[model samples]
Target: MRKHLSRVLLVLTIGMCCSISCKKDTLNINYGAITEDLSAYLYAYTSGMISKASPIQIRFAQSVVEEAKIGSVATNVIRFSPSINGEAVWEDTQTLRFNPSDYLKSKTTYIGTLNLAENFFQYP
Candidate 1:
């Protein structure tokens, strides 16, 4: 009986020691508040036909609001510049759309920058 009790106690002690010594790694991901500047791209499209005098339409994906003083605000700020020697063209505007009559170019690349801001709960 003594030996049996001793063996049971020893096994229990070993199990307790192993359980206490065991360690596990945990990963914590925080979806905290993030703030940064972002830019987007806009492309001009035309039919299958190619010509130097062909009209191009400027199109952008979607605009997001990064910051607003009052209600929700969504707009695009863009600028336009001419492209030469296969170089990229620059376009800037706070509005979303522009007309071909506003600028004249052929076989050019246009650049666009999109600024988005939103408000979320910030823990104190």
Candidate 2:
């Protein structure tokens, strides 16, 4: 009788294990895309007046501009002021160029501006 009882308990345990193993597990997953806006800036230093034509390269810094239009791009525009006393100087917009070495200047402190436009991505 004791042996029979032990066999019945072993059968019940095996049945329970098989039932749990037959159950299926459910899983959920989601995916999407992400994008970031781009931006640009300008930089430069001061040198005394120049006697002959001298090239002054403007420096650029890291900047970010969001919500850019799809087609519009960013361009750096540089302006210059030539004054001996650093006062009462004239201002003019130079042509757009990737490198600052393309421009020339006489006695002046140069300022640079980066003109950026938004393309397709819009800011939230």
Candidate 3:
């Protein structure tokens, strides 16, 4: 009887310990907050089969400065200012809309780069 009582108490203690230490907890993820030690970058975007005669829209993953200079390089290896008369609108805190004065050339491959100001990445 004594041996049985000790075994039962040991099992109960282990069960209690497992319940206290092995339970899964939920994680709350804040998508907008940039944690420390992460390198911030501008993610360029494109949609499939954009109409050449219509205006082009570019999106980013993070909020950038309103005065960001957008540059593009065509397949000819020549870089030109494609974003003319464009305004950077923070549709949300994380999106940018660029409206160019002219439409993009059809069937042309263009690589874009967003020039962000230094202060955009600085943390207080």
Give the best candidate by lDDT.
Answer: 3
When 2 and 3 are scored with TM-score, the better candidate is: 3
- lDDT string for model 3 (1-124, tens) is 3443333223222221111112244223222222222223333333334454443433334554343333322122112233234444444444445444566654443333333223433322
Q: Rank the candidates by TM-score, best first.
A: 3, 1, 2
**Which stretches in model 1 have alpha-carbon errors above 4 Å?**
1-76, 81-95, 116-124
Worst 10 residues of 2 by lDDT: 31-40
By TM-score, the better pick of 1 and 2 is 1
For candidate 1, write residues 18-56 as lDDT tens digits. 011112422232211111111122222222222333333
The Cα RMSD in angstroms, rounded to one decimal, for candidate 2 relative to the true structure is 33.0
Q: Please identify model 3 stretches exceeding 4 Å from their true place.
A: 1-44, 53-58, 62-85
Structural similarity to truth (TM-score) of each candidate: 0.22, 0.21, 0.38
Off by over 4 Å in 2: 1-46, 61-76, 81-124
* Lowest lDDT block of 10, candidate 3: 14-23
Clashing pairs in 2: 43-59, 49-107, 68-118, 68-119, 69-118, 69-119, 69-120, 70-119, 70-120
